[model samples]
Target chain A: MTTAEITVLNKSGIHARPAALIVQIAGKFSSDIHFARDEDRINAKSILGVIALGASHNTTLTIEADGPDEKEAVAALVEIFQSKFSS
Target chain B: MKVYSLLSLGEKHKENFSFKVLVHGENRNLSHATMNRPGLALTGNFQIFSNNRIQLFGKGETAFLYQEQHNPGLLVNCKKLMQEPVPCWIFTHGLFPPKAIIDLADEMKCPVFSSNLSTSLFAIRSNQILTDEFAPRGVVHGVLVDIFGVGILLTGKSGIGKSETALELIQRGHRLVADDAIEIKSIKGGNILLGAGIRKEVAHFMEIRGLGIINIPHLFGTGAVRESKVIQLIVYLEEWTDTTTFDRLGIERHYKQLLDVTVPFRKIPVRIGRNIAIIVEVAAMNARLDNMGYNATRDLDDTMKRYMEKNK
Candidate 1:
């Protein structure tokens, strides 16, 4: 599996709102997105799962995709991080 | 609660949402509700901007406001809207506060809340995550080559020929973790010391005698090396002299402190063609054996004591 890391930049941290937004974005992609904090891994599309991570802002999250569209999913997530979640 | 059902104005205000809101609360439920609830679920063209503020671009009249605090300026701005058709309120991190900003938000009827974290730390952490910009954790140590499955750390002075010995170890079917400066991190189990890989500019590549800057990885297959390894033992390379007393038996294992944990240590005397790599490898095996409940030094001491008792 290929993995990509993104640092959260929103002023509100990865609280419910940004996490919900991230979940929404992940839901749109066909590939399965798993986020890792240290050793804990959870489904990125799950709202409660992501929130349970308690991933505050600036925390580095590793996103792993294993399916066919893994590369594209990683690329898209990188773009979102680069843009600072403006869209 | 003076419910002034005022209309929003057409002219938009420019406000920066860069400052983080610190909502210090004794309870968890209030804290959770304050940050998760949507501020403005309006049906209008919106432009999300930096600093967590949104700029709405549309032509609507009578923008209804739904918030807890009442600000005269915000009310006045909304009252002047000629084509305001949506009601919106910006979400904050506090439920209620007793400060100048809270008073202002109250006067404007905007909600003020309390957060669990400090404002500055929250902002910095948030920015770091969204941006994917992180600085790798670093450390200071001397990483030597690996023998069998043991990672050996060579320590001494600058001119102790540590690098030269590591190169020799690599030539003997071992792997080099790092040279000169080695970065280590404790991961997973207790006191696991992992050495970092050498940078691309100076990888597999070693500075040695006869040959200069040779790439070992290129010459040998991937199995011939590892970029990093769990440091199992440390070998202190000392100058060779007849007077020097080395560890004749392995009863007591020497330890060196790093970060917070201590690693097993061995002192090796450096002389001409002493086969230091083999000895270091043997030291590592001995340490491993010690871990597996076998102490050669102690066993030899016990044997000698028994022999003396019998003779007596």
Candidate 2:
């Protein structure tokens, strides 16, 4: 499993669009990916689960993935958050 | 096999059904789930008689006893009926037994009860209680919730979010039946499975990962919890893995066996962004639709097939 602590940098936080971008990237990989916020660690590939987290701007989350391509999957998701979720 | 005692019958129905104890039997245990009227036995017919059941003395038997008040053979038949070592006797519809019959019951050390409830009502109520006592029961580690009047049992390994998902469902106005440990019973010979909280009073309490043991009724009010429910569907939440395959089409029905009863089943893959509560809600609604004899997946498939045939 690959784990990385990342902070939400976008002004709007990890809203629908940013969540969708994370899913788009996470979907390409075969690894099982999850994003943890405090007591909740939800599937990164699931848009609603992420949005339900209410992870607003500057919220710190832990992204973890396990499977054959865990490293690549985590890196891709981490990049999405660090890049300010740019379209 | 559970023993349905005559003592339980009187105590349980005493308040609501006005069951009054006239005499206490030497044998307080009842061996049958069904109550039988001893009209045939009272007529001096002991052939193929069930001597181990609760003898119900309704209006017909009481009327016969009155009608045979002057007959010498009447005393003999009544004595024979009371000596069968039967579990107990109940006189219904406010009819007090004849003094002679009560003396015979007292002498035989037989328990006797009288109730103002109609004979049929008493029979039905006794049957319900005895059936519950004799039904097969089991305990399952899951959460039972009532969604849209449908009882759904959420099952999976520990930390798979069964409680968390159930908590969300409760927040959505659904009632929780049992959390963590659900006591289930196969009713009607395993045709229907009824689920309740393990200890009953503690069934509404839930344990969320970080939130210790929280009482659902206290947190969400009385409307958020139910004492028991008939399990209509079972949803298994499995941790999503790369190689695992999930039911995408939902065209074919899947089932989970609970106490030898089969219930419609679904295995939902747990994903980070997936709103499992919504999925569970939809699954419950779909189960309700399925119970109503409608399958959206099959219906849409049939529509597509007909459309293709027309094009052909």
- Per lDDT, the best of the predicted structures is 2
Compose the digit string of candidate 1's lDDT tens values, residues B1-312.
111121111011111233323322121111010111122332222334121221121112112233313543543433222112222222223222235433444444432223233444434443333222121233443546777787888877444677677776777778876565455665443356667643433445554434544566787767666777778788888888888787765566688877555788788888887877677777777767877898776788899999999999
Candidate 1 RMSD to the real structure: 22.0
TM-score of chain A of 1: 0.86
Query: What is the interface root-mean-square deviation of candidate 2?
Result: 12.4
TM-score for candidate 2, please give it: 0.71
Task: Report lDDT (Cα) of residue B280, candidate 2.
Answer: 96
Once superposed on the true structure, which residue ranges of model 2 sit more than 4 Å away at CA?
A: A1-87, B25-27, B66-80, B83-85, B188-190, B306-312
- Please provide, for model 2 over B1-312, each residue's C-alpha lDDT reduced to its tens digit, 9 standing for 90 to 100: 466566766676577668887877575677678877788777777798877787888999888877566766877777666664578888899887778878877888888888899999888877776777778886666789999999999988656888889999999999999776566889875699999865665577665656555889899999999899999989999999999998889988888777678888889999899999999999888887877899988999999999999999
Kindly report the TM-score of the first chain in candidate 2: 0.95
Q: What overall lDDT, based on C-alpha atoms, would model 2 receive against the true structure?
A: 0.80
lDDT: worst 10-residue window of model 1 chain A: A45-54
TM-scores for candidates 1 onward, in order: 0.44, 0.71
Tens-place lDDT per residue, model 2, A23-59, is 6798889887877765445667544455555688888
Tens-place lDDT per residue, model 1, A1-87, is 779888887765666566666767877777777887764566675544555566666889899987778888888777776677778
